[model samples]
Target: MRAITFVPGKQGTLGITDVPEPEPGAGDLLVQGLALGICGTDRELISGEYGWPREDPMILGHESLGRVLQVPEGSAYSPGDLVVGVVRRPDPEPCGACARGEFDMCRNGEYTERGIKERDGYGSERWTVEAAYAVKLDPGLGTLGVLVEPASVVAKAWEHIERIGSRAWFEPRTVLVTGAGPIGLLAALLAHQRGLEVHVLDRAADGLKPALVADLGATYHAASDLKAVGFKPDIILECTGAGPLVFDAMLNTAAAGIVCLAGVSSGGRLLSADAGQINRDIVLENDVVFGTVNANLRHYRAAADALSQADAAWLERLITRRLPLDRAPEAFDRGQDVKVVIELGE
Candidate 1:
């Protein structure tokens, strides 16, 4: 089998490599890879900035869609089912949260994240996962199903937003998503589907990002003048790791607002900020700002439903390019496309 892999902490080490095909164990599903979605995290991993691979030649993918080739007896899924493998696995010594199957909220820093930490990922022709971690997808999704893992991140963020917003008398009607990347765009999709007034902020004004935002019937801002959007947004989902925008999103949200930071920032870029005023705003307005990453099984299921309900044509536009396994490295290039996918197998 051919797989995209990288040696963690080594710059310029990512590429394709031959690896043995995995066999399904009892209670496992052997899935033939169909597509893999690329993102900033993959770039960071290739540049030796974000991942913690336990060994050399670690398979480099987490966002994936596959079709089952084999399934264990008594499983809910059958062979030929389209599925997505969940990325995080609990630690050997499970933390309180992991013990409750909330590995996404692991208190201990010992969890293994597929493609990002410790374990091998799904960037291969085939891989095997425990049946419990495989999420079934709608067959109608086809290549569009590749977006589900990233969509799950959006799903979990909204789940937490609604959960935290319930702390007060909350009825949010407007949302601002900072960054028009896959995560941010998907976040906008969910917000629009919920009938909230959605506004997307990105640096691009006339390219694919803005067009996709418009296709969603949501507002697009170049992020040059966020204040020009008129009123403060009731909810803000920050998917850009740029330091200034992170703080700006927090400072500009509405009263009683909830801000979700879903982007991981690479440090060393400095920006002057008024921590005192930020504190004052949160304190006075009872605002909530939280960071979310990865996802649980429930989030994957929610993401599948969200993708199914989305306008198929609108969802298709978000996919900018699709390449094969040998050209997997190309997916990492930061092009104008909203999403890049590696089509691995039939």
Candidate 2:
């Protein structure tokens, strides 16, 4: 089997290599990779800025959609079924959250994340996952199901937002999503599905992103334009990790607004901010800012359901480029790509 392998903490070590096939244990399902979505985290790993992988030479993909090649007897999935393997797994010494099936909220810092942390990911020709962690997708979803993993991240964020918003008379009508990447765009999709007025702010106004935002029947604005005539959003999904934008989202939201920080920042860019005013705004407005990352089985199921209801054409447009396994390196190039997928052979 050919897989994309990298030595974590070693910059410029990513490449395509041949590896042995995955052997499934009892209650496991063997899946052949169909498509793997590349994101910022993969770029970070390639640049040696992210956390070290559990395995020295690690495969690098978390957003994966595949076809089951073999399944254990009595498993929910069957051979030839479309499925996605859940990424995060509980630690050996499980925390209270992990024991209760909330591994995404694991109290301990020892959880293993496939492709990101202590496990080999789904960036290979074939992989094995326990049946419990394999999520079956609607066949109609096809390759678009690769978006499910990132969608799951936003699903969990929305779940937490509603939980926090319920403290007051929460009838949110407007939403502002910062950044127009897959995560931000998907967040906007979920908000649109909920009948909220969606506004997306991105740097690019002429690329596939702005066009996609327009196709959603939502408003799109550049950051400069948004700053000039701002709308206080009821919910702010901060999908850009740029420090200034994160601060702006916290400072410029509606009263009783909920802001979810879904993007991870790279440090060292300093911006002067008025600490007192930021604190005052939060205290007086009863605002909430929370950060969410990774997803559990529940979110995966919710993401699958959301994809099932989404416009298939819109979902297809999110994938800006597709490359064969050999051209995987080109997929990491950050040149105007919305979502890049490496299509593996069956």
Candidate 3:
């Protein structure tokens, strides 16, 4: 079997390597890898900017889609079932959150993620996952199921946003999503589903991004500044981790607003800001600014449902490139496309 392998913290080590076939354990499902999604995280890992160090090469994909080749009898899954493997697993000493199947909120910071942390991932011709950590998807999704992992992230964000909004008679009318990337676009999709007026801001002046936003019945802004958005949004889903944009989102929301920071910003870039003014804005307006990452099984299920209900053609357009497994490395190159997928098998 062949798998994408790389050493953590070592640049230029990503490559395709032959590895032994995976064997299923009790209650484990043996799945044939179908596809893998490439994102900023994968790029960082390949560049040695992120990921935990390991002496041996580790499998390098987390956004995974596979079809069951074998499964334990009496299990909820069966052969030919389409599935996605959940990324984060509970810490050895289960925390309060992890004990409740909410490892996404693991308080100890000791949780292990499939590709980014201490565990091997699903970027192989064959992979084995404990049935408990596998999420079944609609067979109709096909290779599009590769998106479930990233979508799970935004699903968690939306879940948290609505929870915070419920503190009062919250009927949010408008939402501003910064960055028109997959996360931002999906955030806009969920917002539009809720009947909110959605506005997406991206630096792309004219491209598929703006068109995609328009197709969703949302407004798109081709500017770098939040002030150009024209109206104060009731909710801000900040998908661009740019420091300036993060601060701008905090200051540019309506009273009793919620700002969800979903992007991971690289460090070392400093910015000047007025702490007093930013604090005053939040305090006076009863605003809530929170950051969210990762997702539990519940969010994955929610994401699958969201994708299943979405326009199939629109979802298909999100995936702009697909390369075969042998050419997996090319998928990591920075591109303007919304999603890049590595096809592992038919």
Runs of candidate 1 with Cα error greater than 4 angstroms are 53-55
Stretches > 4 Å off in candidate 3: none
Worst 10 residues of 3 by lDDT: 138-147
Q: Per model, state how many residue pairs clash.
A: 0, 0, 0
Per-residue lDDT of model 2, residues 1-346, tens digit only: 9999998888888999998889999999999999999999989888888866434688889999999999898887889999999999998999999998999999978899889886889999999989999899999999999999999999999999999999989999999998999999999999999999999998885978888999999999976434842679899999988888888888888999898999999888888999999999999999999999999999999999999999999999999899999999999887888889999864
The lDDT for every candidate, in the order shown, is: 0.90, 0.91, 0.94
lDDT of 3 at 312: 81
Model 2 poorest 10 in a row by lDDT: 222-231
Q: What is the lDDT, from 0 to 100, of the residue 141 in candidate 1? A: 85
Give the clashing residue pairs of candidate 1, or none.
none
Candidates ranked by lDDT = 3, 2, 1
Q: Estimate each model's TM-score.
A: 0.97, 0.97, 0.99
Candidate number with greatest lDDT = 3
lDDT of 1 by residue, 60-102 (tens): 8999899999888899999899999999999999999999999
